[model samples]
Target chain A: MHKTLWREIKKEKNYLLAGKPVPRLLILNAGSRNHLIRCFLKSWAEQGEIIVSDSYPLAPSLYEDCRSFIIPFYKHKNYTEAILDLCEKQKVTGVLSLIDPDLSILSELKTEFASAGILAFISEEWIVKATFDKWEMFKVFEANHIPTVKSWADLSEFLNDVKNGKAGYPIMVKPREGSGSRGLHYIESEETLISVWNNAIEPMLIQRWIEGRELGADLYFDIYSGELIEFFIKEKLKMRAGETDKSVSLRDEKAENLLKRLSRNLALYGPIDVDLFITAHDDYLISEINPRFGGGYPHAYACEADYPGLILQNMQGKHLTEQKIKWQSGHYMMKFFDMVFIDDKTRRNAGEEIKQQEEN
Target chain B: MHKTLWREIKKEKNYLLAGKPVPRLLILNAGSRNHLIRCFLKSWAEQGEIIVSDSYPLAPSLYEDCRSFIIPFYKHKNYTEAILDLCEKQKVTGVLSLIDPDLSILSELKTEFASAGILAFISEEWIVKATFDKWEMFKVFEANHIPTVKSWADLSEFLNDVKNGKAGYPIMVKPREGSGSRGLHYIESEETLISVWNNAIEPMLIQRWIEGRELGADLYFDIYSGELIEFFIKEKLKMRAGETDKSVSLRDEKAENLLKRLSRNLALYGPIDVDLFITAHDDYLISEINPRFGGGYPHAYACEADYPGLILQNMQGKHLTEQKIKWQSGHYMMKFFDMVFIDDKTRRNAGEEIKQQEEN
Candidate 1:
């Protein structure tokens, strides 16, 4: 049981309340998330606007009829400067990031953005720091008594467990500090595991593989009211390129309470996604925390969970005192690819204009 | 070398030309090809209409604004009857299938469609059969003197090549009769090759691996005029899920001549895609033949290659004899995913409506 017309009420408090008319959201490093951009556009069209930035000029999200800026790469010395300059020039009222590595950067600059009248949609700095690292996240979950899959940072320890028959094949090797499925290996034997581990990138993690149906939760805590206002969950039916392409919505009271408990135990602000697994034994375990809008957020939005709309409410310094609407569950979301087709003349002119601006 | 727009005049002879007013083309098994459907819709808006049929109701392309039918799977006993009934009901004038395995099925039904005044945009049955199988395609390429990478269907022959220091590791093992990158194994050593070969699906092929920049060519041949009408080639720079996601336009005369020769030698009709790999030695080898539109067709269309329009022209019994105009090369095409977000009410209503029709 995931969505129930959002049973929520705003408490009597202010979260650094700053309401502005026609708020413009600065979506930094918006890499090819055209569908996500469209979702934001739909919810924010009447209330505010969206401004996108990316280091790559060809990022599809940058061409979504928004106020877009071509910024330097996050590692570039002038990257922060470019973002701040754009925010100032565009009079951006809110700031958020899409890429994982850039989340910590945004968290670090939360004060700067707030000083400039821009509310940064980031969790607390420590929470962001801990959640981005796999091992740290595991520890955080364990400390909070959250159901979590077992993981090991040291290879020898993982091997010891494997030899003891406590762990077995079809285990996962992933980057300790990375997001997405990049640098991830699913090993079925000790030989293959050793082969992958030997040639794998350093700072890797070996995790006990969880098999069964996976569930994705897209949750939101009202940054203004400082309360969890939105919770949505879906069982992943299909995955394409490491992102959920097909899912069916569900409601589970136990999972919902676990997530609410997680929020109470840790300071998770704005929109955060939780990856979870329901094992064959009918027990569940937490996998990872994406402290931003998840790729499968569309399923939730379609179910009227409306995180973007909730974020818009936060931008207005307004909170939903109570949710009275009802929406059906068991709705299936199927995702497919559309494209931004740029013509030759438009492309050259845009490139030339950007090049001239950089020169200036 | 590419994107030189129409310099062609209509040839005086008829090409079984059955030009009709407002022709409806049936796109069989229209899977989640939303962008492709959009392309066809844009080109055929003035000419006629697109009638889509898919075995899966959730195929996103079905929801596009067009006449669509939920047909039985191709292997189903009543599949041909359902297709024929849809053709009759929708008054479809042309028919094509997007998937590989269905091509031979469509080719076999060419006469039945033609007898009903509906054109099947398929090559001859032998051509379709030969091109869909890896080993058969290799033999065809060799027979036609087309540049091709050597492939072995027998394990002993491939092992002999490796032992004789001819073909080395880093080779490809692919299903003899499959499309796309499914069941493809990139073997890096003899041991890994043997290990994979032992457990792999039967009737597999061992192919020489050529590493360098890969080039995707989308070419269209007018079945009416019996001439190659459009050729678009791009250098693949990035890939996502074994499909080209980023590419830059390139013009290679040698490659063009090679493809044009292959088309003329074979009974290729309608559209075919050639996956070619450019070697560091400056020569290229044909990898496989996809006897329908390629995934990178959007790049070609962005460059004004206009295969959809060419196909429309075929339906119009009109053909371009020469080429003129030009679109600049080096223009890049980047593909991303957008979605069709259907509301729950609308979704269930559609499902129920389809169910009612099936019950009737």
Candidate 2:
């Protein structure tokens, strides 16, 4: 859906306010073509120019009406240098890294970007690491008395917990650091659990299953003011490819209070997406956090919860007002497929254009 | 999705006002089981009790936590008598019909229900007939100068138009009185048009194909004041079986002004569903209208457009204000499939329960 909807927003030109010229924004690894990326393109375009980068020259991001650059992957030795070069060339005032692997790297290089007078919209290094590692997040939740699904790193410990009547069967065996339901298995019997554990990946966790409705909370914190500016909650109605395919925006006091508390405790700098479950007894249990915009961010954006505006304001050295978070409830979002056609000749021409830029 | 969400609405009960007791409402042909029905069930239940009826005892309507009844089809000899008897027994104060075929029948029987002190929330007979008959509706649109796709009832006339460069190829051959795309076809050549015309049902029309973004408008007229109280427009991004599968709510002054003119011209009482197409040249064309709740009603409801509340107020002898029409824009709705399961034994038991009630 993020494949260059330049025509859709042409009528929106008249609504843009003529403020001080804002600098370009750099969005890293922006070629996956998701709904959240499309929303941000629409929201941020009204404020300032946007620059997107991916590893492939023929990526969808290249087709958008913005500055595009092909850079090395996050694991590459020159990846950080390539991004800094792109930011300098484009005069980027703010840098946002979307994918998971780059969040920690961007957090570590925040100081470098800051030295060049470019604001990095990322959390602190410790917050990024704690949120990405499930075991570390579990410890943080326990310390804050926030209920989370119990887990065991060893099969013997899980069995002992089962024997002690503290946990039950139908538990999940999942990778310690994974997204999109990779290496996830549910086991109900001892024989199945043993077989799965034997073939399981290293650094896996066996977690107790919470049999209830799943919820996602999209929140944001002002890096300068340390105030929670955005808090939107939605109930996940359906899942596909380990992402929320359908969801409904709603108001829940208990869930809202929990997210506010989490914001105060974590002090996350930029956008935050948290996954949790509401048990049969009406208990809110924190499960995980994604430091960037999650798959369900479009639902929040459609409700007029403007996170992109906040990011632009922060880049301009302004605090986001609470008035920006006023949003509607009862909105149900159902996701579907859309397409963009590019002839082979056009793609090859685009590739040649990028090749000339690279050579220059 | 609305299979007795008792826990989700537990917090809403305190907001109910203890005024005069609201009587039970009867919804006819309630087995389609869409999001609008679920919303109405939730909305009306807060004001008073709800009773649903369908031809099948095992319909999805029976599974909802409300009074249920099995009735004969609309064409049955005793259909009117059956509804009247049910209203008398249940002390029903309001009745709403959801299907296309029953709207005219309900409109015809409006006077009978009025005599019995039961309000039938349907438009007048002339309005119902005009909306259902495409040829008549087209004439009405032409009289008002609201653009509509050119159509022809005579094959020779259509061929002459095409030959004279008045129209182009790829026209639509559809049944003159069809719904849900039952006999819809796109003909690009002379031979294909001939073949489709041979197989089409009698009294068919050749409609000009519009290549543009389609929009659905969910509207309501206050029965008490004869005023257009609610209007919500959505750009239909996807459709299934003539139903809006994915849509985004927005405001368009061109479309809104057209709808307002239509409301004043038609003086439509109760709820209305209008379909239009925004042409490639940025022209709005009136397509069709259904005098009952259309498939996209849930999107308006989710935006807090409160059509059900307006209907309830009308039934309660109160006038709806302009404040009820205020709603949020940019709300997106994505519809998907959900299931409500009932075992063989439970279904049989429900059937038996209905049979006992019928015998009584």
Candidate 3:
């Protein structure tokens, strides 16, 4: 073990006794995680020293004055060790990630970080697995009494439903494990479904089309207390690149009730992002729940549901109050393209660094 | 006058005494106006016999088992005469249009339709002019106390605002009389602003960008009763070709209030579509209003805020009821591409029809 790791383990015993605030936060895969960076810089900068790590130097350039680490991508074998080493050296007290792949990796090693006196703001491994795996998430939905769109794992089942008039034409067929809008196909008829079925990636899911509005709920649970602390719902006004590019925050009574019910059941720590559709029949049918911060979190934050502030307060041994989660409604977010200019030399340097990191 | 026209004039006065519902609905430019046709076919088909007319034959073929007329495009000099002739011959009582350019033409001849005892679902000429002319619409917003983005017609005035920080960088510069998202440029700096200013169309308006969610309000006013009957607000969730491709219906008090205020103030006696943005401060900034059936109105219709029902009921001389406008909230509409198949012979025939109409 590294010297700092062993030393941190020794200090882990006295951390509670000393009643010290968390000294630093390690934000993993900070490149392109602009929403996370904005929240941290805007709300939580005073709480702790923010250290962001990405595989490329250009990723760090997005920040003005924050610390940056050009660490290897999370896919590398040495990635976990590098994060651990960085945590030990910088006295990183809280570790969290914004990327999807890093969620599971960091989650599985939650205990390791805890042993070194650092809190990893990730859900349990099982929860992470359940979230990313669509079929498993569907099972969770059923167990929780959450209304979800009718889905089929096999094509024959879908065809049977159509034949029986239980489900009509214009069924949705997509890869079961896909994220965002990738591999999504709206099959309009039996002929179209039959033609696309074989070409679709295996382990696909066909779902009954829910004709209604799509709403996204950004949620937070206290890591220390394991209680739901924040709930913010937005009607997705527009989407681009599978992320909410335009959204308006609204307070829907049924959606809020659903969120409260889901929080009571899931009992997971940290932020949970939810995707759901309000059907023509006025039922909230949850499509998926992601066990991480969502791209639309900024909309929630702008509404004054400051999850970062909640997390930071909890990190310092504070508990959530009813007042913390209250937010202004009717606020909206319209995302526009922004640019970060870099010279040719700096761009080339960042490219070379990425290449070198991959080789390593 | 034509003999048919003279006969229709006599029959027109007796329509109320005869108590016959509109015998036929002539939906003009029915081709490519799929959303409008869908609403009419789904909701109003029982009310009247549907007669869809388009310059191209293929346009009307999308409707299964309905009457179709290969009329000349409305811009054609004899277009109004042709429609009047069709109304006389077919015993059509309702003449509404779906295309943009045809709106003014129909509205201008609203009295002519009334003389024939046909109801034309169009706004007054002044309303159409105010909606399409951006500068005039801004003046209306100003007069109504509706919060609108600051705009400048002169480049020097815009530059002064930028200098004073009233407007920041990345301001939108576009043609003063433009529609859709065409000719809109986001100028980030003085250099870029100067570069694009010369290339931009004459008589441009430079306005501050509203950094928030875009909202589309679908509204209806009873032409007979002269009262606002239906209102549905949708957050523009996605855009394609400068039109709302996907949207979710939302019920916001402020947005609703704004729509009500606009409706009460303007009193356009037809479906009035309003576009606005909910800013970061939760202000509803009115952008523009279209005095016609908006492209995104189907989303609202799907939510059960049946403006079509309101219109159809009023066409039968029924007054607005509260129950007619009641809707389920949280409903969304995700638009998908649908195909209308035309064989080679049908397509060629449609082409020949369009060419003949153009030549005429």
Candidate 4:
């Protein structure tokens, strides 16, 4: 790790000597199991050190040759100013966010970074809001003539529409700002819809049930040239708690074309993980658009596509060349396993239970 | 101005009394145009005190209400720490950039702000670069499937394409990173293209010229909802060096829809000034996208649309319910006039020439 850091520092000094600016990328909310952030930090650490706050204690993977600082998490008024001071002190050239809630904060911080000639990746506030909201994403899809499952803002409105044949039974109901699938449910009858509506919030959307299995595509685009450089599509073979547990990559030309058309219509520039349902009629309807890095992003990394590297290049005002995905062509599974230290008594009880079961 | 300041302060106090968070915006720059800075200070002084460096003389408009300090512009290593100290002292809640180069600096400052839960507007470094480069903008358009005039990276490449019938004459040439069309030229043939390219050190792009009168639209969108709240479209009646000399607001449904679509596709939020060319064949192609406040933004203000106010609302995380725009429908122009304070001899010579012309 020390050797890597020394080599990176030497490379940066060489670039500086050649009059080429080397951008220092700062990662906020650094501790995550997501492969995108890990790969991003690893690649970036090879170029320059990343400054991370002390809040992230578990994931030491990102600490390899990178500097870490203990700082308060987002909730204080001084946070933005503190970051500006850090960038100035360290000569940080860029900033990146690996989580969702931090997107808005990143957007706001971009302006401050700009005054000092540093770079940050944040969209306009409204665009960030629209892309974050499920209902708003649908509105943009509708406006751009992109096909999507029929959706409504309120459950009552959805019920009325379904009763009047505007929507159908077996509709999907979920919260407007929920993560995972904790509150999501499939309703097959009027009674279920009424029950769900009574408990749900005022601004929830109801959409038609997509018939086929779930699939996802991770795509990156050049904001200036509107060129699609890398794409990875995977079919979810299994899932646990709304997170992909196992998936298989498929080379479907139709899906690729659909993604192209959707991105073209939306003029998206950054990383986009789109969820689609291939229906009974062989049509694809977008279920959701995650504009930032998604949970199963490691799957893309496993396929040999470094999304964070591409993003870093874009931030430095460099054009991206075509990068081919060396996809691992087989099923991959991720299991969430936990370990706890057990007392001797508990261990004996567990052994006894196992012996009893074996005897039976 | 004093009266307005007092009233705003009283209003802000009332808001604070009612348990509402008083919105505070921070500006980071090395001081430009005293009049413009004073305008912002006057407005802010009504609600909150202005903060600036003490090295520069305080503008008369902000003398009493503004707070000035001593700080280095970009030389400090611990700039983020210094900003945090300032924020702690002033209790700031938001930030804004008063200059172009400051955008990147602001972006880097977002990380600290995110940790503190404050809001900002500058885009991240990647987004800023994509929007700032004209050639990259075209690439993004193509990647997103938005139709734009044909463009090439260099004059030689453009000429070769033209020879092969891949391109045509009467092209538009400009520096990829130029502002206000300083090095922009309308090339009638290869001769002019070569001449313009040879004279400029900046990288250039040659685009097929869309022959028509220029039009610009300044629009703001609800980032969360992807809804257009305020829009202003106008025809450029006169221009001096790339700055609009005169313009008149016009209502065209087609143009309005096109702008809205473009904004959604780009996931654009905040202030966007789009330059367009409506071809003789009635096709509209994007000339450029400025992801910041334009010189003629005040025209939107005159039309009863408070764009800056919308930005403030988004910063405060407040939803916009009703925003109306009122057009006066008459010709309006902003002429760029120059003034020179010179010695007696030069002034006398210029005065005589003006007097002679007037007499004749």
Candidate 5:
């Protein structure tokens, strides 16, 4: 597989040297209205062309320009088949997935693509699995000498350590695959820890919570070449229900250096969100690696970094030139507001009651 | 357009927060691919799913299971139309282009996608034009305090200066839109310069040929935010017919720093190949900016840096993380070899000729 990939790279290089133009790209999405995917899609659009698909009828209308397709049956039934059908029908040049559940299926398909001489860009299955599993990723980081938060997989061992005062309180507990802070709790005492552990059905990883709002850098690396290509840092302001409410782009040379070190140590490829805890010691402890594009991608884009464009270039086997990104260092908040509509009858009743109160 | 883009970013963010799955992406290329685009595609694929377009008809045989289509028309016809038609017919979620001519057209189509909330990435048009045009890009760099080789637009002026001993000979001359060193010549005297200038039909830019072999850096930046993302330095091993015979990837902190300074001064976007001359004084003079993906991207990829992934992540509005790339410093060369087939009769004839010569 590696040899084939290398051959493709060589071919791409030869064609480029020959002054032949590169081909256009197309993106495929199962979910029509995902903000993160949309950001990537937009980035891809900057480079070539795009199309969208939604198995759900009420899919968001944001991707209106992309030819939207309805595949309600494909959602729960045979997603792979559905995708295959789409590929055959649309003459899709490539396929990319943005979610975890799709990884294995994509990996399987990647093998097929490889056999067909079509390039399927699924990460090494082992790497994806290891990174997705927090414990596995930590092991890799530890082996590579990448600094990370102290974590324990077994609750009993963790509790024992805490009882002995080796592990302190105020640690965090959450499911291994959970997204957004779901079912996560801060345990300040043994009793709370036990209670939370009992209530949490999903397997969990325990760690000492890093003190500070989440500050992260999303980095891209070439897995084959082990080269760092681009990076962005964000100070997460508000995270509600596992989503950041407000965040701002920041510049820190130290943070950048640290991330660079970690990327090299991990032999990272693709998008990795390195969670960090800035502590009183003025140091950063690696939290976790979200092995995909993060929600704050727009901040990078708005900052004038065309990361999406970079990815496209890399896949096509081209070199990146030095770029100047215009990052705005100011408060940028993403707040969610809910809209509620009241009927005319309710409005009139409420108005009458207010009027009566005022008259009295 | 910016407002709409923000809205889409927010929407995508919400989806990620809600734990909705993202989609897969596909990248296509005809020749040497864009490193930035490839990196981003890989990044997206790491988290989601990805497929790359195949230029050869037999490529489908290589990548059978993954989604891919053969759009032979893209090679020779209107690339934009071919891409759009493919996207519409295939239900692709997004589109991207990593090369020059495609970027301009993609920028124009970004709005069409935006109106429908379909994610389309388009860098600033003026930036694109300025950076792609070698002469204009140099002008921008100079105006912005970016250091470059002293150049002259008028050949007569340059010749006069050289004849007067104000400038040295063996200068480099190139056409504005020329690629792969085509039509580029080294003129050592006023007579040679005059003859070449008069015969050249295209507007040309002339610069003192720095006494150094070609060395370049593939760098990425957030053009909107002005943040330096990723970079790598490389040395050209050989050149033939305007293409490198062997391009090797290297790591140099000093070169990276110089490229960073240049990027900051230029406020560049997309793919940028900055050529530099390491002077006797240890000062690096900027040669030019490609403003698109260069042919040497595979070297970086071989070194494990995924630049294309970074661009895609940025376009998706995700935060970029810092990644450290560990480069293999041994002499790596991309050598070109041609494959030819001969029938048994031809082989026998060749063998007989050899036998006759030996007998003689």
Candidate 6:
């Protein structure tokens, strides 16, 4: 918290602008994010490079046509050290993660990472932690008058709302800190609600069920100005595994304004994806904000959102201009399955011992 | 259905023996099955050819480096005629569907398909329809003394069993004809059971909850012998979107015998995928049977099960000898995503009209 240390860290964050002609972006826990990694590689074509690090040696992205190596599991004692070493050795200028918990972990190590001249593309520590809890996030949105769905963490509050006819049955009950549709339930009546509440082993958050279209937004902001540069919106047509499987890009003034308001209230950094549901009244009720790249980022990249390119320019100390991003409005993104193959003889060149122990 | 037609169909099934050098294998509804199709193409390199057919032009498999075209949707009045016409034109000797409902549809048109010198690899029509209903399938299993999961379709029957202390709480409620986890609920109390039952729009089947390891078996039977040829077993390490994401090949004698018993109870032909649950007592309870290729089939292919090669050999009039399929055990199969780029101008050459109408 010293003033001198703060100044030094800020200077180191823009280290690439000093002299480096190319930037190496490290994607950690790059598990099946081959699509996102490919987008980075395509934009960085001959000027820069992309490096992937995952605890598992067989992560599909590791075997991609790029420099990849294994790192200790995120929970390991030497996890931070492994990343610091990789960044230093590979000359990585900016790093990002694909997992949620790792957002706070990476942000909390700002001093360590900044001192090494590597910028971790994550929000502040408290902001990242706040996004993890649904109840806390709902309160944050309500406090700022941001549009969000009605939620209740207390059983009595939910029952009182029902008694006063403020809410009705056919609601959602899910873990307070859940993601990707796991541990989520749809209660059609009071009987199911009571039974689910009594049988819960963890704190459950309840919300009014919205029967409308779901939207996923990928927002890109300027590093220095902290101004929204591009907001790519997509209407999720179908979902598989709680992730967007098929979507079509669109431009909605109402949704864009809500996202801008969210940015003003949170002061979040670059490249965050948000989930929202539009009611019949056309109100965009924000559900959650993932302060990291989501699975649907590729859709934006496919539509020429150019987020990776913009981030690289920012790391190079380039001031981005606000422009009318001319993205295609009716393009559809359809996702499918693909795979790679490797044998036992072809194994990791780094962190082999650590990976094996953690995998067991 | 006549004796003369039956005799003529039997003769036409062996049409490959009439001096045809390379037999063509057709895979219908080949959506995102690039992995499985690649296996077939690899084995048929110079000896045979692999053809793909689907109703949608943008199907990822249709864009692969192989002969692909779109047909009418399976529900079309000329669906069977279209497949027959394609088989006659492309010299396709063997045809197989990758969907459950299409099995009976293709098999019912046996005379038409056989007349075109194409053998559809599906079980008899009755058997394929039997697998669609969970309650009926359970009764079939019980009558045949096959090891299967206990199911209750009638609410009064379930209640009587509960009163008799034969059933307990923490059960499962799902659609009677469901597959792959949709509409499935884990009920922990009577209140939830009654509530979920009352709100059901369709018949929901109840089942005893089993806390055990889930396994997926890719069974390949001989075309002529009607005997199990190769049973590729994989323990599902993780699941995504109701499909196996990561699995490891394994050998379990108890489970193999149960699969063998299932083959006897139902004379399924060629390739079939079955799901099983292993209890603490090591009892392999058969859950459901998908009478077609499954998503986890690539795991079997990666382990060198070589079902595609075997099926091709059968089509070429080469009788396969019973041998121990030496697929490597303990090998892990992890799946990831990859994609291809196609602009609007590079649209499908065939079935574009049909595809657009259906997509709308």
lDDT per model vs. reference? 0.76, 0.74, 0.72, 0.62, 0.57, 0.78
Considering only N, C-alpha and C atoms within 3 Å, which residue pairs clash in candidate 2? A334-B334
Residue-level lDDT tens digits of model 3 in A1-360:
112234335445544455675456778876656655767768975546566677755463333345556777777888888788877766788888878999889889999988988888988788788887777887888888888888888778777877898888778888888887888899788888888888775678788878999999988888876677778998886665566655667788888888777764675788889898999998888888888888778777776788888777766767775554566555645553222323335445445544544455
**B1-360: candidate 1 lDDT, tens digit per residue:** 101112111111222236534566889887877777888888776466777768776677777777566778888988887778777755677889888768898889989998998888888899889987889989999998888888999888888987898888889898998766889888898898888888985778998878677998887777765567778888887788888887888788877777778655687788788899888788888888877877677777777787777777777667656355255567778777665655556555545534544665
**Model 4, stretches more than 4 Å misplaced?**
A1-15, A41-45, A54-62, A264-267, A321-360, B1-360
Specify the poorest-scoring 10-residue window by lDDT in model 5 chain B. B335-344
DockQ of each: 0.41, 0.02, 0.01, 0.00, 0.01, 0.30
Best by TM-score: 1
Task: For residues A1-360, write the lDDT of model 6, one tens digit per residue.
Answer: 112334324435644665663677889999988888888879876555677778787687776667677887799888887788777766787888988768988889866777877777777677788899999999999998998999999998999999999999889999998888889899999889999999999999999989899999998777666677888998897786677777778788888888878654586777899998998877789999998887888888887888888888877667877657677566666677876555544443434634543454
User: What local lDDT score does residue A122 receive in model 5, on the 0 to 100 scale?
Assistant: 51
Candidate 1 chain B weakest lDDT stretch, 10 residues = B1-10
List candidate 2 segments past 4 Å from native.
Answer: A1-360, B1-21, B163-165, B321-324
Candidate 3 Cα errors over 4 Å, as ranges: A1-22, A60-62, A321-325, A343-360, B1-360
TM-score of chain B of each: 0.88, 0.89, 0.86, 0.75, 0.72, 0.90
Which candidate would rank higher by TM-score, 1 or 5? 1
Docking class of 5: incorrect
lDDT, candidate 2, B10-75, per-residue tens: 423432347443655788887645455567667776666667788765456566676567777778
Candidate ranking (TM-score, best to worst): 1, 6, 2, 3, 4, 5
lDDT of 2 by residue, A1-360 (tens): 333346325423422337444656788887545455566678877567677777864455555665566778789897887788777755678888778899998899989989998988888888799887788888878888877888887889888888999878989988888777888888898889989888875778888877998999888888676578888898897785576766777688888878777755775788888998999889988899888877677778777787887887888889765554566556666554332223345455555644644566
By summed lDDT, the worst window of 10 consecutive residues in model 2 chain B runs over B7-16
Task: Name the best candidate (by DockQ).
Answer: 1
User: Could you tell which candidate, 1 or 2, scores higher by TM-score?
Assistant: 1
Candidate 6 structure quality by residue, lDDT tens digits, B1-360: 111334324435654665664677889988778778888878777566677878876676776667676888889898877777777666678899887668888878866777766777887676788888898888888888888888899888998999999999889999988887779999998889999999999889999989899999998877766678888988897887677887877788888788878654487878889999998777889988888888888778888888898898778776656559687556767788765434444443435634533454
- In candidate 5, stretches whose alpha carbon ends up further than 4 angstroms from where it belongs are A1-47, A71-77, A223-226, A264-267, A319-328, A331-360, B1-360
Candidate 1 residue-wise lDDT at A50: 74
Residue pairs clashing, model 3? A212-B332, A213-B331, A213-B332, A237-B236, A237-B237, A238-B237, A238-B238, A334-B212
lDDT of 2 at B331: 62
Q: Least accurate stretch of 10 residues (summed lDDT) in model 6 chain A?
A: A1-10
